[model samples]
Each structure stands twice: as structure tokens, then as C-alpha cells.
Target: MTDSIVRVAGLTKKFGAFTAIDDVSFTVERNKIYGLLGRNGAGKTTLMQLLTGQQFATSGTLEVFGASPVENARVLQSLCFIKESQKYPDSFRPDHVLASAPWFFAHWDAAFAARLVDDFRLPLNRPIKKLSRGQLSAVGVIVELASRAPLTFFDEPYLGLDAVARQIFYDRLLEDYAEHPRTIILSTHLIDEVSNLLEHVLVIDEGRILIDQDAEQLRGSASTVVGKKTDVDAFVAGRDIISRTGIGGLASVTVAGLSAAERAAARATGLELSPVSLQQLIVQRTTSDTAESETVTTTDAWSARS
Candidate 1:
């Protein structure tokens, strides 16, 4: 609802005979950190490419900064895209990249970049190609944070980073973002790690937008109930079940949208209530979708044979 920095409508992208990004539509509001989440080969990268003008969409409209992003200088100027596999010139060093960053990013901060370099312990004089994978990822993280672009996309930016280094990236990101508010889209497999940093979440499954909701709302949207199999099943009879598993007479069920009374009733009935994390919820949802799709395909094949 707030002023959106990116507006997409019926967007689709394909490669020869394969569709990468299916018809997806969503809005990315300004000054918020969004988690672009999904499994591998789920079109998260393709969607980002389309938004950043790295690849043309096969169909539908995508607007960045209220205009077409493809070759639009005005829109491109305010964007910075950092990725795990980012390449640099063979002759370039950390210092050289830092020196040239200002030319590309109007809001580049040299002082901040220097601080980040120290934080990540990057060697300024060493050739980029010689740096270790963690060090290389650090360089990209430094540029992304220092760029201060109005719209930034980080696609798997911490591939080779250690836990400590990844924490540093998160800390620096939060600190810098507080001082300089900007819209950031983070794409990564480390869902639980950055779950706290996200304000909104956009989950894509099989090239389609699956979940678009506020992080806080999603946090409390579902609860896991564990009890006797029959009792648990009865309690969740009409509820939107995200997932359900049973062992002998005991059953554990994850249901969506339980009211205060419902929770109290479950507790009174000796059913244990537990919170469901965002990562768990998404996994369950996507897995359920996949299973359903497979089932439908099998059914169609069987009907044809019959």
C-alpha cells in the first residue's frame, strides 16, 4: 500500500521451450527489506533478472521507479544488484573495485566501504581472482551495502561466507539500512537466518507467486497442535491444515488461523500448541503443492489409460 518502488503485472519469462518465470504479479514497496524465497529452480533468480533489466520478460509489464527498467537510465541508476557469482576484471583488486564503485553508484560511500573492508578483513591489494570464496563474497557484500542504491537486490550474496562473516553482513546491513532507508530484495536459501531482517516476504513456487504477506503476520499465522490422533484430527477437522503427521496414537498437526478461543480450547483438551516458524510453513506449503500437482498428473494419466 505504501509507495511501491517496483510494480509488476502478469510477468512471465521463458527460455526457448522452458518457462522460467510464470505469470506473476506483485508490488515491492519502498524502504522495506523483502525476502524473495523459494526452492532451487523456482524462478527467484529469473524474477530478479526481469526486475533489474538483466533479462527481458516474455510477457506482462514490470515497472521500476514508475518506468520500464529495460535500458532506462533513470531507473537503472538507482539500482544495485549483488550476487554470489559476481565477476570482476582479472586485473582488478579490492581497492580497484572500491575506487570504481562511485562511478556506478551515485550514493556510494567510501568511508562506509572502508569500514566494511576492515570488518570483513578483505585484502585491498590482493588480486580478486586470488581471494578465497568467502573473501570474494565479502567484496560483493561490501559493495552492496556501500552502494546505498534506492533499490538493491542481493541474490545469494553469502554463498561461501562463514557463520560469523554472514552475521557481520547482517549486522552491517541492518546498521546501514537504518541510517539510509532503501528498498532491498534479498534472495537466499538461508531463510531462517534472515527471517528477522525481512519486513515483507514474497515466496515463489514453480515460477508463481505463492505467498505475499507481512513477516509479522506470517509469524503468527499458524500453530502446531499435538495430541491424541483422534482428538487432534477432530480439532483440526475444518481448519486449514498446513501439515499433519501421526505416530501410533499421537498426532501432530499444523493448522492455520486459530483464534484465541480455539487455542484455549485445544489447551484445555490436553492438546499442546506450538508456534510454526516461517521457514517451516513455507516448506510445508510448497511441498503440499508439489504433492498435489504430482497426484493430479498421475490421476490424469490413469484416466487416459482407463
Candidate 2:
């Protein structure tokens, strides 16, 4: 049986002339990591805000923890949202923020937070306003991890952290989650970096849910075929084509899943099949038609390789 902690139906958020999160709906299960992915201005942030009750929805229904999240202390208590530009008190220091986290998060882990502070090399005494962009981001990362909320939202949480610091966050998150499982929703532009960490993915494009599926399933859901233009056309005739490009006699086409027999058939026909990465697949799925227009053809594709 599926355990859904969050449920939304026909949810929509509009801002006068613009529709930020247009009619969208999906479910979030317990004890899993979800990636809310999309291109810039695709309404990723807007959706997160609506879920966290930072903004009221223009229409539709959404429930968190079996109740509306808007101004509900009970529901809000179980959520910790960490964003890139997370603000702090004017005079607050890294130590101050960590010191006060427990007041807001019932499950806040001081010891774990301290360990993360050291791991990120965050200065305790320095005022937040004086910290570098990376150091500031670390402060938020520390709190979100240590909060241990039942449902945590990390919205571009590692904005300025260097590669090493980011890795530390990922490693610690996975390690801690193993010991204390909880539902986590992560929204970021670094798809490839967090791709492996994601168990499930919810891709938003143009304020609508574009792709919702298991990360593992998405890994081998698409394949690119390369060979002669005429041969490629014949092979992918009725198949879902994602994007296609050609020069002279050579052509490259991406298409949806193909059965083992189909793959063998393509190989026999002298066609080269390559697996599409999660990032590449989402890019192909959400890439604007104007941009893909330069590629030559259209349809859409997914690979059956696991």
C-alpha cells in the first residue's frame, strides 16, 4: 500500500497576468527523497512556497499531513524549508541561529548540527552578514539537516557552497536519513549532482507537472539512436522521438523505451543506441520547442534499459 503524506489535486497559483503554478497535482510518500526539478522560472519555487504555506494558492486543493498547511501550526511544525536566500536576524551569528533552531523544530538535533557546522567549517562567532555567500548557505544546510522534520524542503539549499561542502551535505544527508528515515523534497538546478540521491522525481515545467516517476525507472527510460538518416527514420518510424539532429548522411535520434528484441533489431540494422542520463532526459522532456527546433525533428523518447 502507498503511504502518502502529501496530496494535491488540481492545484493552481496565479499572479494577475501570470500563472505561476498552473493546475498541478501529485502525492508525496513517507520516508523518501523527492527531487522537484525544472528549468528557471518553471514555478519550482512557487510550488514549494504554496506547499509550505508561504503563499496562498489561487485555486485547487493541497493537503500536508492530512490537513491544509496554510497557517496550521500542527502541520507547519513538521516542515522545515531551507532556501538559498534564507534570512537571519541582523545581529544573529551562526552560533545564534543554531542555538535557536530547537525553538522551532521539535526534533532539532544539536549534536548533529554541531558536527555539520564543523564539517562545513562554519565560523560560530562571526555575524551572518559578514559571512561569505558559501558560509551563509552552510548555515541553512546545517539547520535543515539537524531539524529532522518529518517533511523537509531544501530549495536550492547549496547555493554557494563549494563542491566539497556540497558533497559533505549529500553524504551526511544520506547517512543520517538511513538512521532516521523521513520524507524530503529537494529542489535544485544541480540535477546530475543530486540525481543518484533522489529516489523519486517530480519535474515541473511551465508551472505544470511534466514528469513524475521513480528515479531508477527514469535512469533507463530513454535512448538515443545514431546512424544513417534514412535508417534512423525507418527504425524510429512509429517510436516516440524526443529530439533529432542530423548532418549530411549521419543522424541522431532519441526515443522512448525499446524492448530487448527491439534493441537487438536496431543493432542488427547498424544503429548505435545510447542510454540517456536522468538530467538529459528531463532536459529533453522540458526543453522548449524553440530551443529543440534547431535539433531537426520532434516526438519524444524513453529507454527501456534498467
Candidate 3:
């Protein structure tokens, strides 16, 4: 097998006259956690749909598990896609979903699924229609984690989960992945919370990929510098400033790509520079109108900013 389990070359998805994912391409390696990050309507969901074979791509080549996945039972059987607003039948109950999961997944772990239900305090007999938003989200996480699909896509898996419950979910995920490694693509906006768990990150902006890099590499790409407003502005004048703020004589400016020389210079100048966080970098790099702007970045500067 190739190093990548899923590969998309020039992938595009259009909804009528407008495109939801454009010219996007990437390779997902096995046994690594990938963060599919972007603002709302930035095509994150659309891209996941394409990768899971839930929707057809309008153009370009797509391969999952080294073969075309369109209506292929062998390939579809190995994929698990738990969506944020996942819909169940009107009369469906949480127990019903659990009961039927094993029929579709070859590696379904009933014991693990039951443990997750108890861990999340989910009511198996509760009607899905009557479940709270948070409870509904919990069920999706349970199913995705227990399914043990070779390639899993979690689209906003922890929507209404509280901080404690979310942490528990993360803990369980890492523990299980450690034992049975596979490809997991998690799409979420809670960047900092899950940043440490991701091995790789893909930042989508307005239907296009803005950044594709190792999570560790991103930690050094940008930094925030604080100092006198004049000094801050002067130091930032010739560089690419991702964001800037000031109050009276003091200023804080976030800049992209601070090399060793620049870091040393900042230290000498008494400018306190802190590494920019993954969340802050993501929010700053994505366009404000990303939901419907169709304004994908045409350059590499956005990746640097992110």
C-alpha cells in the first residue's frame, strides 16, 4: 500500500452555479490525526462529504483506500462519517443506531460501543427525536469511535458537549487510537482545544485549501510582538502583519514568518514576542466572509499567516 490511504487531486465540488470546494487536493496518511479546520461554510463539510463518498465530486480525481469509492461496497464498508447535524429516522432511538452499526462495519466493537454509551451517560432507549442537542452529539461520537472504521471522518463531533465531557472524549480517542491506529480526519473550529491531538492540519478558506502542514511546524510560523506602538509599527512595516492592535502608546502586532535573526532582533529591542496560537492564527487567516464570499486565497501568504 502507498503511504496515503486517501488521495484527492484537483478535487472540486459545485452546487449549481456556485462551488463549495474548488481545486482542493491533498493526501491523508494512515494512522495520523488530521484536523480539517475552517470557519462555518468554508467548505469543510463539503470536502468531508466528498472524501466519505456521501457526495459526488464535480471534477478531478478522488481515491479512498486506493480505489474509486463511488457506490463501491468494499470501500464504503471501511468508512465511518459521523456528521454534526446527523439525522436519524423519525422513530429511531439511540439503541436502534447502536444495534444496526455492526451490520455495516466489519470491525464494529459492541463492547467498546456500550462502554462509550456509559461513559457519555447516553440513554440508549431515548428516542433520537427527543434527545437534547448535546446528547445527540454524544451519540455520534460514540458510534464513530466504536465503529473502528479504517478511515473515519468526524465532522464537528463535539458540538454541545461541555468542557469536561469533551476532554473525556479526547482522552478516550487517544487511548483507543494508540491501540488500533487508523486514519482519522476531524473537522472542528475548537482549534486550541484539539490542537495538541492533531499530527497534521488542513486549513480550508472559501472553498480552497489555505494551509497544509504539520501541526508542530505551524507553532513556529507566526508570532505576536508587543512593544511601544512606534517600535512595533516600524518593525512590522516591512513584514507581513497578520493582525495588529494598540492602546495608547503600547501595541501588539501579529506577524508571519519570524526567522532566527528577527527573533534575536526582537529580544534586543525589548519587544516581548510570544508564539501565535493555532486557533488565533486560523481565525486571522480565514476570510471574514468565508461562509459565502467565494474568496479563496490565490497566494501562499495565508498559509504563512495561519
Candidate 4:
């Protein structure tokens, strides 16, 4: 079995009365791409900061590569964290950043970095402060892909890039990852775009982990059952329904944990079973009417039946 590269148990971080991360726990396996997904202000960035040792936890433990990452150069050396709002000295040019990268990343690929620079069309001589937002993002992407760090964290690395540029970044990342396997945690809001690239997914909602599971397993975990009102209601009875909708005499319900026999039974009843997109599932799981209420509430009727 592959070893766990990152482990967290009961990790929590607070600021004054506000908790940024609340009793979160999960493990990241080696050489896999994980999507750290959530809505805005959902503590995704805070959690990434904790994992990378940029911020300390208020309570509980965090282990990266079997050791605490805090003030440990050895642990930090194996990581490359690229954030959306990365900053550089006003006087420094794009070439200066590339020149300094080799000193930090032991496995820096100068040739690959050069190629990426050309591909992104970054102006090496222009001062970084004067570059467009997209160009700055390109600089970060180039360094991250060329660094070949054992574990990399990209927190919305494609923030300012257009569709074409984003595709370039994704293509390059996939190509490099294929050749050199490494652990990657990508925290982004673009769920559907990167859905296929993820092996696992970690979703945070209101400073808590709402979902942590294999990507493929999650894809099949929830489905929408649609048909006549009576048929759909009967088929989804005693099932965990996350959301429901109706039009005229028909009803569609989003449900979880349906087995083959159960699905076959639904099909037998003339109900249409449609796959739920990852984005749709997540949005449903995180939406709530009250701030205190947890997202994705199961049906009380289903519980009683079970």
C-alpha cells in the first residue's frame, strides 16, 4: 500500500472568537492528486496554510511526511506552495525569480522551466510588479511545475488566467505528473474543470470537513432519481435524500448510498437514475438556510425506516 504523506488528527485553528478550522482530520496518500474544494471563506486556504506550516494550529496535531512541519527546513524543502496572490520584490524581474528557484528546489529543471517560460510568453526582462495578473500567475505555474517538489500545494493557481491559459497549465501539470509522480493538493473553486484530474477529494464547509473520500467512489455515491411523483417517492423511500425538486406530476430526488439491487429496483419501477456532477453534489452538500446548521441533512423519515 502507498504510504500517507500527510496526516492530521483533530486539527483546529482559531482567531479570537472565530474558528478558521474546526476539528478537522484526514490523511493524504502519496503520489495522488487531491482536490481541496469548498466555497469562499470555507477555510480551505487556512487548512492549506496549516499543512504547509505557514500558520500554526490552535489545537490538535498535524504531521507532514511523519514529522511536524513547523520550523523544519527538511520538511519545507520537499514542499512547493503556490498561492493565488503570490508576491515578489518590485525590482525583481521574471528571470530573477527563475534564477533563484534552483537554490530552493533541489530537483529544479532549468530546461523545463525555460520551455514553460516560452510557452507562457512571460517577459523575462520586465519587472514582476509591472506584469499583468495572468503573467504573474504564469510565473508561479512555471516554478511549481519545474520545481518537481515531492509534495506541492497550489491554492487557486489559475486565478487570473483565461480559459486557454488555464488549459495550458492543466495540460502541463498532467504531463509532468505522468512522468514524475508526486503528491499534489489543489485547492480551487473550479470543480468541474479539474474533476477528472483528481484521485481523491477533500471538501470543507464552515471550517469543517464535509467529505473526504476517493474521487471515483464519490462520483458514484450520490445520484438523482427522477420519475412520476409516486414512483420516485416510493423508490427513494428510506434513502438519504440530500435535495429534491418537482415539476407538474414528476419528481427528482438526489440521494446517497444506493446499492445495485436498489438501483435496479428503481429502474424496474420506471424511474430514471441520472449521475450527479461533482460540483452539483458539493453545492448541495454545502448549502444551508442557517449558519449553525450543517449542510447535507439526511431525511428523518429515511432514518426511521432504516
Compared with the true structure, model 2 gives a TM-score of 0.91
Indicate the residue-level lDDT of 50 in model 2.
Answer: 93
lDDT of each: 0.89, 0.90, 0.88, 0.89
TM-scores of the candidates in the order shown? 0.91, 0.91, 0.91, 0.91
Across residues 197-218, which tens digit of lDDT does each residue of candidate 3 receive? 9999999988999999999888
- Residue pairs with backbone atoms closer than 3 Å in model 1 (clashes): none
lDDT of candidate model 4 versus the reference: 0.89
Q: Could you tell me which residue pairs clash in candidate 3?
A: none
Candidate 1 vs candidate 3, lDDT winner: 1
In candidate 4, what are the lDDT values of residues 197-303, reduced to their tens digit?
99999999889999999999999999999999999988888889988989999999999978999889889989999998787788778787673234333323322
* Rank list by lDDT: 2, 1, 4, 3
Which has the greatest lDDT?
2
Q: What lDDT, from 0 to 1, does candidate 3 have?
A: 0.88
- Give residue 247's error in model 1 in angstroms: 3.3
Query: What residue runs in model 4 are displaced by over 4 Å at the alpha carbon?
Result: 290-306
Which of the two, 2 or 4, has more lDDT? 2
Candidate 2 lDDT by residue in tens digits, 1-306? 378999999999999989999999999999999999987899998998999999999999999999999999999999999767787889999999998899999999999999999999999999999999999999989999999999999988788889799899999999999999999999986677899999999999999999999999887788999999999999999999987778999999989988899999999999999987787788888878687753213223212211
**Model 3 misses residue 65 by how many Å?**
0.9
